[model samples]
Target: MAPIELKELKDQLQELLERGFIRLSVSPWGAQVLFVKKKDGSMRLCIDYRELNKITIRNCYPLPRIDDLFDQLQGAMHFFKIDLRSGYNQLRVKEQDISKTAFRTRYGHYEFLVMPFGLTNAPAEKLYAKFSMCEFWLSSVAFLGHIVSAEGITMDPAKVEAITKWPRMTSVTEVRSFLGLAGYYRRFVKVSHVWPYP
Candidate 1:
């Protein structure tokens, strides 16, 4: 907290670097130095960054329209849903924008290998690209009853096949928990379809 103590800490950090106990990831915003370990696996130094995230640009992206999604599902009997793994992380920030993504943790300040959730332009740009890709896939397979919310409802095997082809969705869960208006039409699904039959 004192100026002399701070100077001493920095000098110690420099000594650690000189002794091969850390590595640095250079960015235009600031330099992030990381601690390294020796073959014995003991921590050899400390890293810290409380100054970076404060200056990083904040992110804002519009949420996709839900009604537009429902419109895509006009007619279908079965539905399969897909969710992306670390979807935001799948995108790469512009090289110049990387420094803006730096965050300080107890260990050290680190930039993301992919776009992080905290950036001003990240959400809009990333979502736009993702939705645009979905729209393109929908348009290309117009006959598959319109992708309808990155989730789809259709009895068509072709639609199931298409949904399965998506990058992350490998298995389709087929236990119906809610039937909506269609429940009234089925006279026998074992009991009053309005309530749990079991």
Candidate 2:
């Protein structure tokens, strides 16, 4: 880590500890921690839980599908987006399972007393809770990479711009990847039964 990132990491660790989200642990299980750069040039701490997730039993609670969410938004006059801060940290981890969330840092080994991101069950756990702070939109609101409004759902402009500016494909793999991304908005586009190649 860079000197700045290291300092940020230490600060974040202290903050998390003070907030009662994590505590020092002596668990045999430990994951690695790293910092990712946020869009606004801040470091966001993340833990690599791939090893833990591999052995863990997954909770297959089905989350609301995007199409289903959009269907419910139809004819709405206003919209509000709730952006949760430390959303996962708001949920407590079971006493016995706390050690499973342990991660080691140069500072020390710590385990989350609350849930953390990157866990296989985090999404399912989210369904049980709600958070504070909201942004209200009278006309439209950007949600899950799409815009919802009284006019109905449309692809978010930023995402559409990104798709338009996507790099030229150089291989079959790249072409498939691009198609996979673009295909998400296929519902908004017109399609023809006749094949252009055939």
Candidate 3:
């Protein structure tokens, strides 16, 4: 689908503001827009930019090296993970690329007021900076024990073992491999007396 014009996008933003679905905030990076619900109880305008991200250039930022990560974990045996809430939304995209990042949805097309995922340079320019800054701060501030970067909270072995014991769970590797070979050669291999099918 084609992108919406700037005029139309602004109109949509205005309507959302009028309806009290969003509030505007100013930041050093740029305009930071946030979603707010109306008193009557309705959702605010939110943009989804998955498609635009496909065409944008990805920022080239080097992640922590494996050796560095391992070194940090040397004395740690247990780990817990936490995900930042709306991490990308905290960033602001460059002014020049804002139009290119406009998105369409059922209600209307709208541009992001803050940085979003799937945009080119979003990872390196915004995400990396925020994450690296946090990492730096954590490293500089000493803690009782090491806290490794993880995507989710750590669970005890008993909880994990209970999940493995779920009913109907079965191994299918042998069955899948056998069926794969049979299907692959079905045209050449036939059931016959000479074939001695098993």
What overall lDDT, based on C-alpha atoms, would model 3 receive against the true structure? 0.45
Better of 1 and 2 by lDDT: 2
Winner on TM-score (1 vs 2): 2
**Who wins the TM-score comparison?**
2
lDDT tens readout by residue for model 2, 1-198: 888878998999999999999999999989999998887898889999999999989877777998898888888998877667667877889999999999999899999999898998775335332344566665788787898888888899998998899997788888777777777788877882433220
lDDT of 3 at 124: 36
For 42-151, candidate 1 gives per-residue lDDT tens digits of 33323233355456555555555645555655554444433354456567666665555554333344455465443444453333333332333231233323333334
Off by over 4 Å in 3: 1-50, 65-70, 76-86, 118-120, 123-159, 166-198
Ranking by lDDT: 2, 3, 1
Question: lDDT: which candidate is best?
Answer: 2
User: lDDT scores for all predictions?
Assistant: 0.44, 0.84, 0.45
How many pairs of residues collide in model 2?
0
Candidate numbers, best TM-score first, in rank order: 2, 3, 1
Write candidate 3's Cα lDDT for 47-127 as tens digits: 444455565566577678644664676555445433454556666656665555555443444455566554545553333
Please report, as a residue range, the 10-residue window in candidate 1 with the lowest summed lDDT.
Answer: 173-182
List RMSD in Å for every model shown: 15.2, 3.3, 14.1
